[model samples]
Target: MLNAFHFQQPLWLTALVPLGLLAWWLKRHRHNDNAWQKIIDAPLQALLLTEASGKSQPALLWLLASGWLIATLALANPSWEYQPRPVFQTDTAQVIVLDLSRSMDITDLKPTRLARAKFKVEDILAQQKEGLMGLVVFAGDAFTVTPLTRDNDTLRALLDSLSTQIMPAQGSRADLGLLKAAELFKQAGLHQGQVLLIADGAERKTSVQAAKVLQKQGYTVSVLGVGTPIGGPIPNVRDAQNQPIVVPLQVSTLQQIAKAGGGIYRPLQSDDQDIQDLLTSGKTIQGKQARQSDDLQHQDWKSEGPILVLLLLPLAALAFRRGWLLTLGFVIIPLLQPDPLMASPLDKLWLRPDQQADQALREGNYEQAEQLAQDPLRKGSAAYKRGQFEQAVNEFSQLHNPDAHYNRGNALARLGQYEAAIKAYDEALKQQPDMSDALTNKAKVQALLDQQKQQKNQDNKNKDNNENKKQDGKNQENSSSSENQQKNDQQSGQKNTEPSKNADGQSGEAPQDKNSAADNHTSSSPKDQDSRQAEQKKPASDEKSNNGKEQKKDNQFANANQAMDKNKGQEQPDENEDAIKAPPQSSQPAPENTEPRGDPKRQQAIQEADTLNNEEKLAAEQWLNRIPDDPGGLMRRKFKYQYQQRRQPAGISNQTPW
Candidate 1:
C-alpha cells in the first residue's frame, strides 16, 4: 500500500508548498523596531535600531511551516493502489422450460395459463443472481430459444416475445422440452443444472420418463403447473359443434413427473411463492467445478489527506497563542472564505456588475438595479420589470442575443407597437431558430392586432350605419317639410279661386233682383212706397255691413297666403343650408386632410403584413380572424397549438396584451 501511494491532485502540492516556504521566510526576517528604539539615545538611534536583535523562535516558525506543508500535502490527495485477491464464486445454471401449446392458452387462470406462466418466469428472472439461465420453448417439439448465458436481457427479450405462433407445430410435448433443456446443460458441460418447467400440465404419460432421464443426468426438474384443476376452454380452437374445446390442468401428471425426476411440483398461482422457492432451490446447488485462484494488480490507495489535517490541529493550537501570527491568520481566513449568501460559485469568484444589479433588484431598488446593470440583457430585464418598456427595448436592442430580441419584442408589444413587436420576434427567431417563447408571443400579439383590426372595422361599419341613419332622418324631414309647403300653396290657391266664384254669384243674382224690385215699386200704393223706402234704407245698411265683412275676410286671406309663402321660403333655405353643410357619404378612403380612422396599431399591422412571407401572412390573418364571433375558441386554440408545436424556447416570460 505504501509503495503504491501517489497524489491524485499533485498540482495542488506544487502550489501550496510555496506558500508554506513564504510563511517561513516572513517569520525568519521579522524585526522588533519598537524595542530597539526604547533602548537607543537620539544620536545613536539609527545604529542601535539596525544592530539590535529581536526575540525569534526558529523552532516555532519551523513547526508552523511544517504544519502548512503537511496541510498542503493533504490537499494533494494522497492514496494507494488496490490489489485483487481471487475468491470462490458459485457456478450455477437454470433452464426455464416454457410450454407454448394450445392448452396453455386456457383462461382458468385470470388472463390465460400461458400469460401467468410468463409472469412467473419474469419473477424468477428478477430474483435470480449469479447464474447462467437458458430458455426452452415448446409446443409439439422443443427448441432452445437462448443458450445458457449470464445475459438476462437477451433471455428476457426472447421470453417476452415468445408465443405459440413461433412454434412449428401445436401440441403439449413436455418430454421434448425437457430433452432440449438437457441438451443445453450438456453443451455447457455442467454436471448439475436446475430445470424449471412452467406449463399448463397438458402432457403425455411419456413426459415422466423424460423427467426421470433428466434426473439421472443430474438435472433437478421442478414442475410449476400454470392452470386451474377445472380449467377453461382454449380460445379460437373449436370442436365439431363450433364450440370451444375445454382443456384442464393435468395436476397428477405434473406431480408424477416431479416425483420421478426427484424434485417438487407446484401449481402456479397469483402469488409467486412457487417461482421464489424454485429460485431458492437452484441457489442451494454448490459449484461442482474445482476452485481456482488468480492474483491481479489494482489500485488500493488509502487516503492520507485527513491524517495530514489532524497533524495541523496541534500546530494551530500552538500558533493561536502567538499574537501576531494569530492576528495574521484571522485576517487571512476571512479573505479565503466564500460568501455564504451567493448561490452561484462562479458569482463568488467574480464581482460582476450584473451580480450587484441582481442583488439590488432583490432588495427592490429597481431603478438603481437598472442603472448598475452593465449587461444590456440584464438592464433590459430590469427596465421591463419596472414598466419602462421603451427603455427596455432600447437596452435590449444593444445586445445581439436571441433572449434580448425576444425581451425587446415583449417590451414593444407592451407599448402596443405590435408590428414592431412582430419584427422583433422575427429577429429573435432568426438569431435562435428554436426560440419558442418569441413565436408564441408573436402569435399572441399578432392575434391581438388582428382583433383590434376587426374591432376597428366593426367600429367604422357602425359609424357608417349611424351616418346613414342620420341622412335618412334628414331626407325624411326634408320630404315632410316640402309636403307641408305644397299643402300651404294649395290652400292659398283655393282661397284666391273661392273669392272669384263668390263675386260671380253676387253679380248674376243682383241683376235679377233689381228688375223684380222695379215692377213691385210701380204697382205699390203711396203708403206702401213710404214703407218700402224705410225697408230699402234698412237693406242698404245691411248690404254695407256685409261688404265691409267681405273686405275684412279677403284681407285676412291675403295675409294668410303671404305668411304661408314666406314660411315655405324660409323652410326651403333651411333645407338647402342643411344639404350644403352635411358631409358626403362614400365607400372610399378618407381625404388627405382627414385623420386616418381605426386603431393605428391595427393599420400598421395590416401594412406590415404586406411585407411578410406566406406562412407569416397566413398566421397573421388567422390571428386577426379570432374576433368576438369565435365563441368556440377555435382560433385561439389553433394559435396556441401551432405555437406549442413550434416548440419556442423557454426562459422568457410572456405577458402579451391578448
Candidate 2:
C-alpha cells in the first residue's frame, strides 16, 4: 500500500510568491491573440522561430520552479507510513540483581561466576535501548546498587564499581536482594518490571522472605542460576605468606531461593547451548496472568523521517541549478529562521531580564533593577554580599528564582518575623531543594527562635527571682522591726519601783518588800534568765537566715562558673558563648608585598589561620605585631595568629579589648 501521509499546502499556495513584480506584470499584460496570425505579423519568420524557442525556455523555467517547490516540501522531513496506524504498547522495568558475594570468586566457569554475570548484564544493557534497567547486589544483605534509569553510562559505571568488598558483610541472600530490588521499584513508582536474578545459588533459604516480598510487589522473578547442581568446593587461596586460607560458598541454595520467589530457575552450565536455552526459557509462568508486554520489534519512525529528508535533499540539490531554486528558497528559508525576538544564547551570557536585574543591582538602582529579573526567580539571586535580602527578594520574585525565594526567607528571618520567614523559606526550599541558603537560613531561624525561647525563660526566671528577693527583704525588715519592739518591751518590763527596803539592807516589807523577794526569786529562777537570753538571740538567728540568701547567690555564681568550665572542656561554644562572641567583621589584612618566609613557624601559623574559627582568627590577628598591606605579609599574619589561637589550650582567658 502506498501512503502519502495526507499533507498538502494551504489555499495560500500562491507559487507566484517568488516571481515578484515581473510576474504580476506578465499576468496583467498578457493577451490571447491568434498565434499564427501574430507570427505572420512578425517582421521575419526566423525571428518568430527564435521567439518560439524562447517560449520553450519559459516552459523549462516553469518545470524548474515546480522542482524547487517539491524540494522545499521534501526538506520538511515528512514521513509516509504505508498503512498509517498507531502502535500501543506498555513498557516494563527490568532489574538485574547480581550476587557480589565472595562465592562468586569460584572458577567454575573459566573466569568466575561474577565476571561472567557482569559481562552478560553489560551486553544485555547495551542492547536494551528502551525501557528502564537497574542493578542490585546481594552479599550478607540485599541492597540496590543502582536505580532504574535510561542513562546506561551511569548504570554501567555503577555496575563496574561493584565488588565483593562493597557489601562489607559476607553472605548470599538472593531473597533479600530481590526484595530490595522490588522495594526500589516501589519507591521509584515502577509498578511492573522483570527481576533477572544472576547468582550462584548460595542463599535460597536465608532470603526466602525477601523473595516473597518481591513477588507480592508485582515483579516477575526470572532466576538465572549460575552454578551446577553438583557443586564444587569453594576456593581457598593464600596471599604471599604460606598460611592456610578458605572461602566457602553454596550455589545450590540460590536455585531454591529463586523457586521460592515464584520464578523458574535455569542452571548455569559450561556449554553455549545451555546459555542459549537459559536466555530464552520460561517466558510464561504457570497459574499467573501475564501483563501487556512491549513488543521486541520497535519502529524507528523518527530516524526514518530524517532519512526521507536526506534522500529528497539530493534531488532538491539537483533542482537548485534549475528554475525551482527560487521557489524552494522562498519556502524553506522562511521556516528555518527562528523569530529574532525569541532567540537566546544557550549560556545566557546575553542580556536577559535576570541579567538586566543584576546590572541594575550593580548600578545601585535596586528598585528599578528588580523589574528586570524573572520568575521562579523573581527574587534576584542568592549571591548577595551584604544581606540585601529585601531587594534580592523583589528582583528574584520577578524572575521567580527559588534561590531568591530562599534569600527573601533569610531576610525575613533577620527581620525577626520567624514564622512567616520559615514559611517563605519552606516555599523557597520547595522550588530548589538543594538551596544551602534556604537550609542555612532555616537552621539559623530555628536557632534564633530557640535562643529567644531560652532568653524569655531566663527573663521569666529572673523576674521570679526578683519577686522572691523583694518578698524576702520585706520579711527580713518586718522581723527586724518586730525584734526591736520586743527588746523595748523587755527593757520597760525590767524597770520596777519598790515600796520599802528591809532593815538588813533589804526592804522592811520583806515578805511585802518585792526587792528582797525578787533577790530570792532571781536565785531560784536562773533558768528563767537563760530563757530571756535565748529570746534575745532569736533576732541574730533571723539575721543568719539573711546570710543564707547570700550563700544561694554564691551557689548560682558557682554553677555559672562550672558551666563555663564545661564549655571549655568541650572546645565548642554554647549559646551563651556564641551570644558573647562578636559578630563577623571583615578586618582581613591587606596582602603583603614582601616575599613569604621559608620559616616553618610562619607556614604553620598561616595554616592555622586558614582553619581558625572567627574567634580564633580574631585572637590570632591580635597577636600579630602589625598586619602588613602586602599579600604575603597578610598571609603570614593571618596564619601565625590563627595557629597561636588554635594551639592555645582552654582556660586561657580570652580578654576582649575594652
Candidate 3:
C-alpha cells in the first residue's frame, strides 16, 4: 500500500510552492528589512505584525499554503480503490501487407500482378463479415492504407487508389512490411492477429527475422504469392544495353517467411480457397468465454480525490477572514446572477448548444433536439429523424452547401416527391461533381419517377375504358327510349284514323314517317363508325410511345444495377461497364474520363492485359477507371510524406532505399 502511493499529476506539486512549500522559499527571498523580529519575542512579534505584513504572518501564511496544497491534490484526482469493468474483443483481426514494388508492374497475371492482388483483397473483404481488417502497402518503405476497421466500403475505396506508381521509392522491402504489420496490431491494443502478406517475394534477407519477431509477439503471418513461376520483365524499364530486367516469382523466399512466422503460404488461385486457408490459420486464445465472464466482474481504480478535499476545510478555516472569503465570493456570485438563467436551459451552462442537442437526440428526444439545434443542418437532421420531412426540407432549404442540398433531396424523397428530390440532387452535383452519393441517389430517384409515370398511365387507361363503357350504355338507353316514343306515336295515329276508308291520308302519312326513320338510322351509323375509328387511333399511338419510353428507361436502370452487382460480387466486368450508364435525363457522363490515353483513339488502357484473365475480369482494369485522373494521387502524397519522415533521421540510412 505504501509503494502504491504516487501523484496522479505530479507536475501539480509545483503549486505546493505557492501554498505551503513556499515557507522556505519566502524566508530565503524575503524583501522586508524588519530587524525588530530578531530582537522581539514571539508574542511581541505577533502583536506588532499587521495584516499587510508578509514574513511576520507565519500562522496565516502556513494555513493558506496547507489549504491550497490539499485543493491541488484533489484536482490531481488520485485513486486507490478499484471498480470492475467488462471488456469484449474478437480474435478475427487481420492486417494485409501488400507489396507495391516496381516488379508488381509485371503483366504476367491479368492486367498486372498488383491488379490481381487488389481483386484478392476484395474477395477477402467480402468474405470477412464481422472481422476487423487493416491494410499496409510497401515498396522501399511501408505505409498504412487504413487502420483495423470493420467497414469494408472504406477498405474498397482506398484499395482502388493503390498502384505500383503510388510508392515513393522503387525497391522491395518485405522486412519493413512485416514490421509495419506488427505495428498495426500494437496500435489496435491487440496481442494476437493474422498478418497476411500478399507479395511476389522478399528481396531483403532480414524479412525472415522480422517475421520471427512478429510470430514471437503472438502474430501468425501468412503469405500469398501473386505471379507466375515462368517469370516476366518489369514494364517500361531496360538495362544499360537496352535489355528488360526479367524477375521471376521467388516462391521459396515467401515460403521461408511463412515458416519463420509459424504460418501457412499459398499461391494465388482463381477460386476462394487461398483466402479460406489464410482465414482458418487464425490463433484463437483458449478460454475466451470464461475470461470474458470473469472480466465482467473486474475492478478498476476508484479515484479518492473528493474525500481528500475534506482536509482543506480545517486548514482553510484559519484563513477565512483573509483568503477564502474572496475566492468563495467570486465563485458563488456568477451563479447568483439572473442573466444566464433567463437565456437558456440548465444544460447550456455546461454543454454547448450542439452538444445539448446531440445528447437529447441520443435520449430519443427528437423534438427537443430540433428545438435546441441552432444550425440549419442540425435542425433539418433532427426534424428528419423525427419524421417531419416537410419541416426538414424547409430547414435544409436555407443553406447553399452541397451537403444541405443532398439532405434536402433526401427529405423530399421521403415526402414522395421524387422529381423535386432529383432536382435537389442535381443542385448538389452542380456544386461538387465528384459526389458519388448524389449520383447514386439521383439515378434511383429517376427510375422511381419513371415507374410512377408508368403506373399513372395505366390508371388513366383503365379510367378511359370504364368511362367509354358507361357512355356506350347511356347511348343505347337513349336510342331504345326514342324507338318506344316513335312506336307509341304510330299507335295513337292508328287509333285516331277511321276504319276501312279505302284511300285515307293517314295511310300515306304512315309510309312517309317510316321512310324518314330509315334515313335517320343510316346517317347516324356512318357518323358513329368514324368517331370510334378516331378514338382507337389516338390511344393506340399514345400506348405505343409510352411503351417505348418505359422500355428505354427500364433498360438503363437494369444496366446500372448490373454494374453495381459486378462491383459487389467482384466478378468479371463487361467492356461497356466503363461508367454507370444513367438514363438520357441524367447529366452524368457515360465515360469516366474525357482525357486521351496512349492510344488516343482508344481512351482506355484495357487493350494492355494478360493472357490468364478474361477481358471482362476487372470492372476497373486500369487506374483511369474512375473520375480521378490519377487514381494513386492520395497514396503518392502519403508515401512521399512517409518516405521523407524516414529520411529525417540523418545519421542512419534507409538500407539503400530498400
Clashes of 3: 8
Residue-wise C-alpha lDDT for candidate 3, range 98-185, written one tens digit per residue:
9987778888998899999999999998987766789999876788889899898899988878987677655577888888888989
Q: Rank the candidates by lDDT, best first.
A: 3, 1, 2
Using all chains and alpha carbons, the TM-scores for the candidates as numbered come to 0.41, 0.36, 0.37
**lDDT for every model?**
0.68, 0.56, 0.73
List residue ranges in candidate 3 displaced over 4 A.
Answer: 1-89, 283-631, 648-658
Which one is best on lDDT? Answer: 3
Cα lDDT of model 2 by residue, 1-658, tens digit: 1354533333323444674454565566454323554646556655554455447645655555555466455454344454333454435567788887666766766587677777777776776666677887775455555688877787776555565544433445566677778877887786666788887754344466566666776676777766544444344322222222233334455555666666666665444543344334423431122234423354433313344445555556656766466786899999998776664545446677777777666777665554555543433443333466565555545544575566667666666778877888888777876566676667668767877875564344434444455666665565566556655654565569444565678645546435444443354345745654465455445444544554455456557657756756756433234224311110112223465699788899788779989987765654342232222333245433543354333111331100
Please state every model's RMSD to the true fold in angstroms. Answer: 37.3, 27.6, 28.3
C-alpha displacement of 86 in model 3, angstroms? 11
In terms of lDDT, model 3 sits at: 0.73
Give the TM-score ranking, best first.
1, 3, 2
Worst 10 residues of 3 by lDDT: 582-591
